[model samples]
Target: MDRVCDGIAVITEGKKGSWVCDGMTVRKVVINPVKAVDTTGAGDAYGSGFVAGLIKRPGDIDYALRLASINSASVVQQIGAKHGLILRALPQGKKWMHIKVEKY
Candidate 1:
């Protein structure tokens, strides 16, 4: 599908990684392997993470894609989209590469 506007992210299921393309460049991101219980909310999780990354790191597309991957990974591990959502803070001992979004 030609849904990609500025850039595109391909979600690879049961694979080692996912990828993002910005027309001029393509970046493959490695995701930590996990057993997915349900995929009902993976897309939303990715979108949320990407947007969060964009908001936190205005011009870093790579960061956005990584955030999206992380979010999607967390979502699929749970049964529902919202259930596994990481509303605040990353996983255990995980540090945000970009500026962490602070609630005002």
Candidate 2:
């Protein structure tokens, strides 16, 4: 938070999960595991999903982060960046609801 400019900072820890900092508080959200065939485009999926979630439901930080996790996990499960073609088309409905986000 000290070094980041006036904006939210998202730090992902691969399979472990991710930490989000907003210059004040830091929130950690764990991700569900998936068999990664290819890690290509996982980061891109996460960023796009997070932004899409925010656009769909502004001010819902948890929703955005969860969506990001879901997106990345989905990408890694498939082979190559082609999985991105189905981005939001993932069939895991309400998947994020089952994921527990540790309250800080």
Candidate 3:
């Protein structure tokens, strides 16, 4: 990742986890488990969330990854791609908790 681009590079791995590299350090995002009925819009959800986080908080890769993970997770819970997507702020309750990340 570092040899290729100078910006952020991300790889989403569904339930297993996700990885992010910013030309320097690499971080691993441990996503919370969710019973997925459909995974149609998971990638789109994560992309939007990650971009939104970057815009909301510049240089905050962790926030971006977490939001992306959360957004993707939500989409997989419902039958349709967009049905389980969040329309407003961060989800409320235990099922919508933040992602756990580790630096590697």
lDDT of candidate 3 over 38-69, digit per residue (tens): 99999999999899989988998888888888
Query: Comparing 1 and 2 by TM-score, which wins?
Result: 2
Model 1 lDDT tens row, 1-104:
23556555455443356656656666666666678999888887888888898899997877887777778877888887688887877767554344232211
Off by over 4 Å in 2: 84-92
Residue 2 alpha-carbon offset, candidate 1, angstroms: 10
> Which candidate should be chosen as best, given TM-score against the real structure?
3
> How close to the true structure is residue 72 of candidate 1, measured as C-alpha lDDT?
82
Per-residue lDDT value at 90 in model 1 = 74
lDDT of 1: 0.69
C-alpha RMSD by candidate, in order: 6.9, 2.0, 1.6
| Global local distance difference test of model 2 | 0.77
In model 1, which regions exceed 4 Å deviation? Answer: 1-16, 95-104
lDDT of 2 by residue, 52-103 (tens): 8789899777888888888888788888875644454544577666655665
RMSD of 1: 6.9
Structural similarity to truth (TM-score) of each candidate: 0.72, 0.85, 0.90
Identify the candidate with maximal lDDT: 3
